[model samples]
Target: MGLRAKKFTPEVLLSAPRRSEGIPNSDASKVLYSVSTYSFDDHAKASEIRLLDSKSQESSLVTDKNGSSEPQWLDDDTVLLLHGDEGGVTHIKVGPVQHFGDGSYIAGTIDGPVGNVKLVRIGNGTYGVALTGKVKPCGDLYNPEKAEKPVTTGREFDSLFVRHWDHYTTENRNAIFLATLYKEADKYKLSELKNALKGSKLESPIDPFGGTDNFDISTHGLVFTAKDPDLNPATHTKTNIYLSASKNFWLDIAKGLPEFFEVPISNFEGASTSPVWDKTGTSIAFLSMKTDGYESDKNQLFVIPDYVTPGWVIHHFPGGSSGQGTWDRSPQSIAWGGNDTLYLTAEAKGRMNLFTAAARPTGLNPVPSQLVKGGYITSVKVLNSGDIFLTSTSLIESSLYSTVPADHAKRTLSGQSYYTLPVDESPYDPKSSQLITKYVSSSTHCGGMFGIYGHQVSEISWPGAADDTDIHAFVIKPSNFKEGKTYPLAYLIHGGPQGAWGDSWSTRWNPVLFAEQGYVVITPNPTGSTGYGQKFVDAIQNQWGGLPYEDLVLGFDYIQKNLPYVDTDHAVALGASYGGYMMNWIQGHDLGRKFKALVTHDGVFSMTSQLASEELYFPFHDLGGTLWNNSESWSKWDPSRFAGNWATPHLIVHSELDYRLTMNEGLSAFNVLQTKGVHSKLLYFPDENHWVLKPENSLKWHEVVFDWINEHAGLEKYTVWRAGNVKKQPEDS
Candidate 1:
């Protein structure tokens, strides 16, 4: 027999190489991207900016510094990179893309660290740059000096946002700043910067996950998104896009234009983001939600026709009915294919697929058609030649880059045929429609250092908790597999009650990693999952522990009845965030007794105490109301109510810095299990937030988690400490 394949253990998983989106230059001749690799020797990560020749498929390191990131192209052959100095000051360095490392020179420096910086050419010699930086209480750039400690160490706030995801809120807020980058005395110099929201209370690129995607700049003006200043951020999800007519960077273009004023572009009371300008700079397109409080509402496409002229109209491309053909999915990110055609990436039937729409003349509501499927399209860029550059990831690949020509052939698969695959059918069996296939053959692959890992991935659907509904799930078989051999089951529940398990790759809770450990991993997207449609996504509202729990139960039964390879009797279940909540839910019910063990990470123990979460709007929307008015709603599906049934071996993981679901949630669950005399362990991280992001912490997290499950499954444990030379426990202590 051939040599056995290497197991992707926690150590190997931590060291897996990663690549960011491939950013193509003007003519699509070269691409700039970043590669990240973990160094267990230092318990740190090292990143390098690399340049790839699109034609030759050859790449070389541009910068070896770990601090460098977010490289942007200044022109066809020039690049700008963001880096932080030893003093923590942020600098933008510019140089020719061909000049690997030494030729780059500092273009400009900000007073402090900034994020989401975007540079655009406005005229023949002038370039404009926009960035989000923290502004201090003194209305000046926030730096170490401005952040010096006061006599009083305590912080006081009059707002509802006393703290955010990880840290307490201060007077400092992130604001958008614009400046012109020009050459002076043969050295690049930035002109006096102007604050986009000078005296306004608004802030650009809302906190937590917002970045450069929140704003866009064109030769005509600048457009950005900011939350509604009048509404309480803790309860509302309204963000609007603002447009500035004053061409601050180009005075010639500013003349005869509307007076320099920043004005709201849309009146819609919902979340608006991803503002982008067309190639001609005559129109703008973005995605927005209509609901006021629901953060997960369906995103509607909107475009501004003839924005440069007076009396511009904001046209909305409606879904469902507004004269448009029936389109049920929501677009997550958008880009202009040309002046009129729009390319979008949206979740569809457990996959993040690309679609094409139109930015029309008027009164025309064109439905978005699926242009490409399979793999998660993380980012897309349309070149001037109408070709599309895409960066995507899938269960087998870490990162991928592809170029689809404007006149590419489309393989239109019948939705009925693709969706009607048998529950036992392997995703690869339907190769033409199911496998992760790029639209065009011109593709580059990176981070596939270990080959395809010798595993089979499949997407299968089973009967749902409700009639006429089906629940979808992704399954991964162990790397080393024999036909008739059975494997322990690792049932993983996704965190977003609003999220779905798709053809995507994730560092945390990776199904491939579990499969490598000799278990059959199944990630089920039951009720409340997106990609199915908005109705299914909204089904979990106020029904938290009802439908989704039943769907998962049915999923387990389906595996037991059909997939002979999956041994449900010898199984363990794990989840984080909402998934964590499901684990606690499973514990209190009959499902808890079926699993050999359970792991809950940053889960919710009690819905009644969910008010402790930072985003009050999440609870407000998901739970239906507040504690005073809807006490029954909060207590109906509370996991604490079912704690008496806990008996399985349990691992509770919670991070101290997770303000979303406070540490108390996990600690409370551990306490309940202990009180019930159940075998349990608590893995607490004081430095982590809702997710374990640090490399070292992540490695430890996987080790402890895998060890717990392996112990219950009768497999070799993975914890390194168990092998260390430690004193044996006293017989009688």
Candidate 2:
């Protein structure tokens, strides 16, 4: 008897009735954070901690709050947790694991001074800390007695025009204070808490999104923070690493007591942060950039040597291909397990994988292996045994897993031997793991299903680059697809031009959603995508609209011609960021009538305005200059220059707080559509940043986008006309 294939419906895929989230944090810990949800709309917004017993091989769930920031083990019994509030205090809780129902463990917050912790580091029973204080600038160190009290108009007020992500203001400026950990019989508490840095206006963890992870303290009581300078936050933010002994320091502008001393020199010309202390102390390893003013430049791994003068010793690792030890892939965070073992979460192809290498500069091209890939590895923790516990999420899975090298101490030192994952070379699967349960829902009234449930999701490749480079693309077939039936295509262009539409699951631009809407979805990760190799990625650098665009065209042509069922005539081009720029390019350039409609979200309209986006370094490094210096270089790629030919109906989406693209970008495109009198609609999210994160907003965004695409391209062409938009013959594709 032949085996029957599993058939799923859109309702089953979109509904996603029930699923348990694995640990979302990449930070290493004995307990993992897991959150379960009934549906997208039915989630309680709280997280659960999954504690595994090494001795018993048993796992239990602990109820936790969504406010929990970074969770780290305090000791054998206690765990330190950081919680942040937008309008309230930063809660720092440290206590022994609390057992709740049955075998579940819930960490209870310590009800003490630790409640206002902005950043913390725990060692045995001793905790080094930084607390937040709201202080209005007064000439310079007005009165220590009046530091806590709000100042009326008795003294001059210092002003800073700070703007970030979504909002701006001076009221939330925080002053960093230092403290010591004191425990009262198992109850964690804070003692000797004083203004470690006074009379200075500096937010250690920055604000909004940054927290404990941005700052690190050395074993010798030296605090290193990559922080926002006390000045007007502008389109360009230059964050220099400040190293100061863990003592009371002050920055009085009037008296000139610079709060923190900056690093004098570095291998890279740009900003630096994420300092990881070597286990033996005396040195620091951090992520660095080569171009000043550009935050998105090639991220290189650098180490700070124990020298008499303050400077960084750049290490030439695998990614650091430049003679000076610079790598292209961006390093998110760094952690040291041993003196020579440095583990990094870096981006390549499309996945953020864990890599291991020597901790210091060897002037050697330290080959870093993708210990764990096929997903987004957010953070890592180093245990005494050298085993790594990490949180990884994919296009279809979520959670944490543990991986141990055969002999990491030796492998990392050699920087040549490869590390391995518990699972073999396959997509990260959550269903096979015993820790998480398969989502089962008895309720039939939830919502709809999606692409992954009803169709096959696979990655395909075709020749694209001039050197016959094979460009990778992700394709999702429609649900219950039949032979000889043509389906409309949702050709999605990924942003980043430097980024890729990875193999992982996503809440935004979900191809499965389009597949559920009765369209064959194809997402091409042409040149500039990571994972492929440095050459393929570097090809898209100065040639953003060049090689990457050509590769997309070739990939699209191949997909339509080869798939047979992909209805190219009735298709649409959709993208965000750099992809959006290509959508505009399509309206002016190639594929005359390939896409019936277009959807662009948070995409660039003009390189001129996009140059100084958020940080000046990105434009400076990528384009090689600003709008003034290299007007001719960026001019050719400007979408508005060729807007006269934009006849296709378009849906423009942008956010007010997306400093990267800025609100004017969408407005400019919308204005051009109005001037051209083209069929267009502008969807604006005032509260959202670059991505639509809010639940309701996201739902609305999906509904609007889903409905728009269906109405324009995904809708079924019921009537069988002699010659419809669909291909008359497979060969015509």
Candidate 3:
């Protein structure tokens, strides 16, 4: 029988193999990683830790029973993972990396559910296990089963962060815990867990999306970051780093709780994160932003060398002062290549490129050299052999592994490497010492899925509507695209207002998914969108409906005039968060007449009502000030003011848990559209947040959105294409 052809659908996207960063072992001989894919039969995501042989690029599943995650290399051959049991209890499992299922043992247990656990080496060959878990007020590990049940469900808060991203604040905050880890009689055992931040009123691994990146440990001690307890979380973004030195250089005995010392940050303030310690633990390097309230400020690399010694100096790279930086791009991820070298993954133009810089430079202007160009480098690891292991993604590929030879003698410095920025505004720039390696393609991924349906991705730039500065955008053409055939345009605006459309893979707002539906997808990185520079990102402030909206207009006009293959007349626009707000803005503006339909997900209907939204810093910084003081600016950009002009068929998707924007925004927009007799539909999800993440809900979202756009664009409703046959897929299906 002929092999059944696979088409890229929401189901395919939801089930596509998702891989974690490929982490190299001590010798660089093998790589350990995790892969997760949505299982339709199980109605949940199925994950497995896999060990990859670096030489042959062959990977074997280490464990899949009960779906394991967070794979770490305990040594050159031993693997550590958080595997779940049949009863859904997470266990710290250890096994030989080479052996699949034999000689594995349940190492130990934590007091509560563990998140982000890692083994750190001490001075005397001893390893200390550090993890983040919740603790009670009495300095004991928090156990939900033993806690007293409350009679009332009511919550009272005197602070601004009443509700973060999705959940309400509780008494138990995420804290770092440290314990001695060792093997006895071939069985791993953990000592009594001690609260690393015992007396601190701050939460390490600051909420919403914090993880292992927030803290790091080495032989010297532990270095972690936590929000300042004195500052208001709603309006401030200051997360200071704290260090706790191990007893006698390496704490071996179960002694007193370690004392925490606030790492003096000098003048730099803002969101300090990704505190990473080198293998020797002699220094700690992290990324920091200079501004107080601005979350999208350029991240300047800071290094604290000899942090354990007295009067340790803090070195801020590229830009030493607040809001002053010659390096325009922000480092998204940072890793130590060697003791003196630092590897960074930063956004350049549209792609996340790998770069190498001096870890501790004496020169005033230390420029970083760009390593590999193009694609998004999600994770980077420097092996003991100095080989660089990387995991990247692109518009076409979901996951890719590549290794760059760190040896200068191995390969010639030709077109592969060069300094990213100019030196002294000179005409000539020297090449880097390293060479790029070919990508290690995924062996398990089906070629038919991406090769047959992957969109042709390219970046296009045009003069901005507000200014002559070139504004960039990503254009994705359907794989089945033809030269003569014109396709409907799917204009996608990103959220963040501080975010950009980069060459990266995303489960949500995927360009490939949109283009697969026979549409030309265009995602614009307008003013306020990051990666362009801090100035460009700051341009959107106080001009939410002003410059950004004009930039979109210019972007639309550019396509309509140049790209004859895109049917701009039947185009549809979609966005979430700030993008959602733009959709509402577009609905009430002249741009509304161009699009056949519009989609706004968790958008702001009225600027005045946005005060009710959480994260006061966001609206406070972007809208100029509070509603009371910035009334004129708020009313000027408010989408609700122009609600009478709404006429385009629209879809409003809002969730009950979206505290960032709240459900009222979508509800108010829908009410306005309905009151004006505009063709509109509201897709409400009580279980969802700002974004749709659940597998089943995502599929339903795609179906409803496709139906709405297809109906308005005079196209047929979406249908599943099987082998040589067109199968009708109902709304439920």
Which predicted model would earn the best TM-score? 3
lDDT winner between candidates 1 and 2:
1
TM-scores of the candidates in the order shown: 0.90, 0.76, 0.92
lDDT tens per residue, model 3, 525-624: 9888887777788888898998889889999999999999999988999999889999999999999999999999899898878777667888888888
lDDT of model number 3: 0.77
lDDT (10s digit) by residue, model 2, range 1-733: 1111132222223333223322222232345443434254464344555555533434565435556544455555555566644434345665455553333232232222222343234455555655444444541212233336656744443643334556554454544555556566656665544544555545555655555455665444344554445434443445666666322222121133334666654445565667666665466777666555554555567676652234545554533345324454567788887776677887765667777766654665555554555456655766566656554555444333544433643554554433333222233244443212112111111111121331256678889866968888878876667889988889899887667786555656666656756788888888777666656666665676778778878887887779888898888889998888888777777663577888889988888897446555566556757678887778866777888888888889999889878889899998998788988889999999989876567766776676677677748432222135224422110
What alpha-carbon RMSD in Å does predicted model 2 have with respect to the real structure?
A: 8.4
Q: Put down candidate 1 lDDT per residue, 1-733, tens digits, no spaces.
A: 1122244556655676677888888767888888888988787778889888866657888898767888988777777888877656788888877874878888787767777877777776668778788887555677765456788777766778778999887777887777778877765666655666667787877897888888887767777788888998888999877776543435633233234333344545778888888876668888887777888888877777756552464555543543321567878998887776888889998888888766673465556667777678898898878777888777766676766656551222112221111112122233455433232212212223433442378878999988789998988887577899999999999988899888777888778888877799999999999999788988999989999999999999999999998888889999999999999999999999999999999999999678888789998888888888888989998999988788889999999999999999989999998988999999999999998988889989998998999889877786643355112321121
Pairs that clash in candidate 1: none
lDDT of 3 at 624: 86
Candidate 2, residue 623: the lDDT equals: 75
Tally clashing residue pairs in candidate 3: 0
For model 1, the superposed segments whose C-alpha errors exceed 4 Å read 1-5, 184-187, 246-249, 252-267, 309-315, 319-325, 361-364, 409-448, 451-455, 720-733
lDDT winner between candidates 2 and 3: 3
Error of 2 at 410 (Å): 4.6
lDDT of 3 at 49: 81
Clashes of each: 0, 26, 0
